[model samples]
Target: MKSVTRSLRILEAVAQHQPVTVGELTKMFGLPKSTVQRTLVTLNEAGWLRANRKDTTRWEIGARVLAVRPAALQGSSLFAAAREPMIRLRDTLNETIHLSVPDALQSMVVVDRVDCTHAVRTFHAIGDTSPLHATATGRAILAHLPKADIDELVEHGLERFGDSTPTDDGQLRADLARVRADGYSVNRKQYRPDVCAVAAPILDEDGTPLATVAASMPESRYDEQRVPELGRLIADAAKEIAARRNGA
Candidate 1:
């Protein structure tokens, strides 16, 4: 109860002060800096708050927090619908499966996931964010969004995470073009050297992507020869999910 109370207070503080800093929170609450820091981290991880990219020390309400209204709940509802399918995919492939939605133009946040039981696997927590230009899951959705939106995201700058990550706008645009043509995106150690992933977008009735489903594994476990086949499996799964969702 005390922990919950403390977290609530932090949320209240953040709501009252937009783009506030840790020092400001600590001072205002008269709490230990470490306690405030931990609370802030927890809130940020839960998608209630986001630290500024330009100034990591400052924090503000996250997109998820800001999107608590009815319309945004569509994604939350999508998470519920995707649960069984994600689990089935994990069971079938014996690999970590992630369901993510666009959190911002430049990132996708994991809403749910099924972790692989393998001794070596790519691990990510729910609510974790991945860069659009460097992740299969992010690109899967990005490829389906408006070109103007994609251009704006690129204009913001692509932060490279790995040697294979695309940093140039032209190169990233070309990559997105391929994703659209192929109906799936593949990340070859672009986000993490040890992890590779394949992903497909779950489209709405209007053909706009609402979310993505991804399968990730250690590079060692990834069979290069099976990449196309695996991509096809995920793409088919995504389409089936979209069909079911539309029917519902």
Candidate 2:
């Protein structure tokens, strides 16, 4: 534990003076050169620091630490709560299953997912972010938010990420209004080309939106006659998650 704390101290010093040298680290931490070098080696091995071979003998943060974040986050941590339902839904539809929470922006944030059986399955790996105006998941949560919150997100401006992305404010408002009347949102290749999604709001007992759930599939395989069945699957799965969340 002492060694761990000491290594963290060295890391802190390195961060404070990033791209610093071993000598500089030794001086900053007032530790022996051997201790600094050993700590640097350990941190580098663990992907916490990078050793630059060029001038200044520079050591910087490694891609390991930055690219792959530790699974330490503060929140309701509800992903675990939905695992069973996600699996059930994945088997039920043989399509990709996704769950996300609302971000500060109008965008939907992917937090968890279950891949489909096919190699050609939709791949929305966890943590992928989706646009508010172009994704079923985003519209699901947005439809349930109050007018003021929706207005705040709209004021931030819509950013286009795909060919069919909706940046027009008036059209987006109309679409959201339709979502309110229909009780679900359907995004047809509006986010990714040739990709489509159906999403439903997961509500708490008080009828407030807590999160959104989506079932995504390829547009080529879409059956207009079967869309209602797909919507039923998504809506039912979302309700199961909501009940567990609200203890209803």
Candidate 3:
């Protein structure tokens, strides 16, 4: 409770008075300088805060925040960033591929998408939220989330989208643990009754899960024999995205 309060306070402070200094935050929040300094320093190191070039003494949100903007997806800005990778992955897998992110408290949506070559293939909603406990994209993002976020999400329980969607914590935890351990995630008909997908989290330099890249296929393409291969392929795609993102 105490830690949550402190982090929230820090985030609120930053959000409210974005370009603020450590001294100013300490004074406004009535927190000890030591405490305020430590929090701001950590945020800065995590790329959540940056020193203003106009005045090195002040800090504000950094480029990492800018990169996630849906508004930036217009024309050259959004497509230039994600189109090539989305195209290449779709081509290689011969399946629908998506670059998706959280849309609401419970759903994930595709901001960018590529259709598969097959006449009959899984389809995804470009601006829709896949289920929290069903899609590989959600699991991949959840795997890297802070413990509080995961626990809070599970307390809400899984929203059933299919017969296989897990509504229990034990199984979700096990699945998420495997995702973290293997650097990727896999889902088998957990969302749509006949759709399966694999996903991996794209990380920034600080190792924060920025977003997810995933491939959707029909249930017919799934089997233990092919699951591992799919996991590897999705992970490779995520790594490629991460490399390009970091470079940009």
- Taking the tens digit of each residue's C-alpha lDDT, what string does model 2 give over 161-243? 67767777787778889877777788888878888888888888778887788888888777777877888888888888877
lDDT of 3 by residue, 1-248 (tens): 27568866886687568788888988887889888878877777877678889988887776554444444553533345566877887888788988877643466766777898887788765556566678899989888878888888888877787777878899889989999998888888887788878888877678877678888888887676876787788788777777776665
Model 2 spans > 4 angstroms off: 1-77
Error of 2 at 191 (Å): 1.5
Report lDDT per candidate. Answer: 0.84, 0.77, 0.76
What TM-score against the true fold does each predicted structure earn? Answer: 0.74, 0.69, 0.67
| Cα RMSD (angstroms) for every candidate in the order listed | 6.8, 6.8, 12.1
Which wins on TM-score, candidate 1 or candidate 3? 1
- Candidate 1 yields a Cα-based lDDT of 0.84
lDDT of 1 by residue, 1-248 (tens): 39999999899789779689999998998999999999999999999999888888899888776445323544665766777887888888999998888876747877677898998788886667778889998889889889898889888889888888999989888989999998999999998878999999999988898889989999999898888887888898788778777766
Error of 1 at 63 (Å): 13
TM-score of 2: 0.69
Model 1 residue 173 lDDT score: 86
Clash number by candidate, in order: 0, 0, 1
